[model samples]
Target: MKRRRKKRSTKQYAVIAFYEKNNRWPAPSSQNVKERHLGEWITRCRFIRNHSPEKLTEKQIQLIDRIDADKAQKKTERWMVNYEMLKDFVEKEKRWPSVNASEPEEIRLVNWCLSQRITRKNTPKSKLNKEHIKLLDDIGFHWSSNNKRRTWKESFNLVKDYYARTGQWPAHTRDPEESRLAKWCSKMRAYKNRTDTSVTLSPGQIKKLSNLGFDWTNSQENNRRSPENTNRIWIERYHHFCEFTTNNKRYPKAKSGDPQEESLYSWWMRMAYLKRKGKLSNERIHLLDCIGFRWGKGNE
Candidate 1:
């Protein structure tokens, strides 16, 4: 008797192997569940199914779905690269923005301004505010902050520093009242000889004389001298002459057994003679002829 052919369980074996590899069963509703197995398993299963595959196991389909879902989630959650961070890395490594050495002086200055760490307001107008002005002034920078046009404080500081380092004040500061007074005193002392010359008026005396319109000049010849004015001028000149002689260590000689005390007019006449003869310079002449100096000779 002919024995009945046994049916091969290749599909069942394939499903088992697929479940073992994936740790999960294929989906029950998938049409290609059987084909989702490993190559050896798929070949055996295809041969078993008469080379006409049907649905795959639910476990295989489920495994594939899980893998696909995991891949999609990973793609969605991938770490992104920050452009700024990349730029920073490139700059540090390659010096991306090239630094020019000597473009223009002005450009460099502008760049310096831009690159400066701005802790305070750098605008000229902002820096010239009342508070900053006071601060700068307290630090010895005397300047005017007006109209927003210039940096007077900076210029003042530069000038002050230059003077301090050089021991010379600016031209504008050299003509102070004290300096002028000192110059005048020196000139008067230099010409105290060669003629009857004297300085009766101190700075205070001169100031008083100026106020009284008694500052005699060649141009003041039009003003005729009154007796009182002449007497006062002579007295002042006499005092100046006494002071000059005392300072110069000059002793007056006596004539005819009497002390040769010169009068103001006599001293003035002698000085005028010396000046006309070109024996005296203008400064000496001026000192000798001054109203106070002329009168001072007699007292000496």
Candidate 2:
């Protein structure tokens, strides 16, 4: 007689075969899929379908349901917190959520509100209202009270631009020393206008005048009368001696024994007169005195 064969149980056919090959159970639901678990489940399914008898098991279905519940609960909690934070930030600040309070986006939003308020309250006409200037001064921005009306708008805009660019106000607008220098320069320029001459001299011109034995520290009229006038006299006397020597055909002597020498002797007398008047330079006077003694000795 033939004996009856026992049918294979589904768990023994499906799950036991999968576990023997892969060492993990199949996932119960799609929501239960995680990186490590999904990889294991896919590998096990392939192994079971290729080598084991194909069947669904009650135990495998219960395991998948448990994983799906856990995934749903975690996702719900994350969604609730994300939505609540977004809503609170937007409603309270009337802006989008910033990554942090000090982030550039939050600072930009604050700057935009300030700019909008300033724009809305700005007046186009040039009536002298000191409200904005006073407000800036109260916040420690300073300006001269005398010039405040003329510079109020400019000062206000400068402070606004400083804060907008750097996200902070400037500590000082102008240096005290720089203000003093500007005032001094203005006064000097005004004095130059009254004097009808430049107050400063070029270095080249100063060097050239020094070479010519001019003293600049003395007043202009005194300079003209002193070394300058004496030098002119010496030049004139030299020219006269040159003319006499050339016309007399002696070149370096006078027609009456020495015409050029006689002209030079006359020039020495003029230089002595200038020296007595405090007009001739010391070097020039010394040379003239030496030449005069020589001419007198020759005459004797």
Candidate 3:
């Protein structure tokens, strides 16, 4: 029997190629399935290298290190790299990394922070080092999703000032501050809708907002073209058409060049088409019939 060498899989080759092209490791959050798989594989390789070095062959270990330099580092060293990156970002930005951060580096830091929070909540205490948690705490990291820097009272006052200055509620605008207020208002509405007793709007907050004539529906229902409004508009137009017919003793000419007459002519044609298709309601048909309205092209 002849000895044969094991071949590297396509994924291994592809991941190496990807790292070479991008100059960065693929992220698990990548939308592309292949890239996501490569990212997850890299994560596993890093973990295995740190915990069970005997599981991976020397050649495989070298390949992973070539693609992901961090794989050569111990887990604690990797953790420090992420922690320093985040700490530097927070020091510069004066805030935690936002999930909505536009930069790839900031987004990576945000995800790293999120993972730490998840680990604190779900992972057993025995598996975690308290020193890491203490380091994060020293930097004012928020373990909860409510990571906003502003207090509720300050936000409420800001909204009041915004309404007073603009003479309208905070709208989602291009200005970052205004947009933040708009998001806060939207969040308040969402909290109000939540059935969970723990997620609730304070009675005082609700009263304060209500006094500002804030619509809790957060909708333009008054301006919406509802079915009832449409029906009323249709009837009003019909009356206008009837008056035109009675005065001229003829249907409005399609090419009359007068805007009102041309509009009525178009409306009449549409109604005729609807009646032919049996789409016009019986009540509307009776209304037209009472006014001796013709449903065919013969009248035109």
Best by TM-score: 3
* Native-referenced Cα lDDT, model 3: 0.68
**Would you estimate the TM-scores of all the predictions?**
0.16, 0.20, 0.30
- In model 2, the worst 10-residue window by lDDT is 1-10
Name model 3 segments beyond 4 Å from true.
Answer: 1-8, 32-58, 61-118, 134-300
For residues 243-268, write the lDDT of model 1, one tens digit per residue. Answer: 43443344334331211233323455
Give the winner by TM-score: 1 or 3. 3
Clash tally for model 3? 0
Residue-level lDDT of model 2, residues 1-300, one tens digit each, is: 112111223323454455467665443222333422342343333323323323424444444344345556765575445445444556686765322244554444433433323333433335323554444344442232222232322332333343345332233213332243234333333443444354554566345434544333323233334343344444445445433433343223322333335446555455556766898677555443422322332343
lDDT leaderboard ranking: 3, 2, 1
Tell me how candidate 1 scores on lDDT: 0.37
lDDT of each: 0.37, 0.40, 0.68
Q: Name the runs in model 1 displaced over 4 angstroms.
A: 1-219, 251-300
Which stretch of 10 consecutive residues in model 1 shows the poorest summed lDDT?
Answer: 1-10
**Error of model 2, residue 40, in angstroms:** 3.3
Error of 1 at 7 (Å): 99
Cα distance off (Å), candidate 1, residue 74: 99
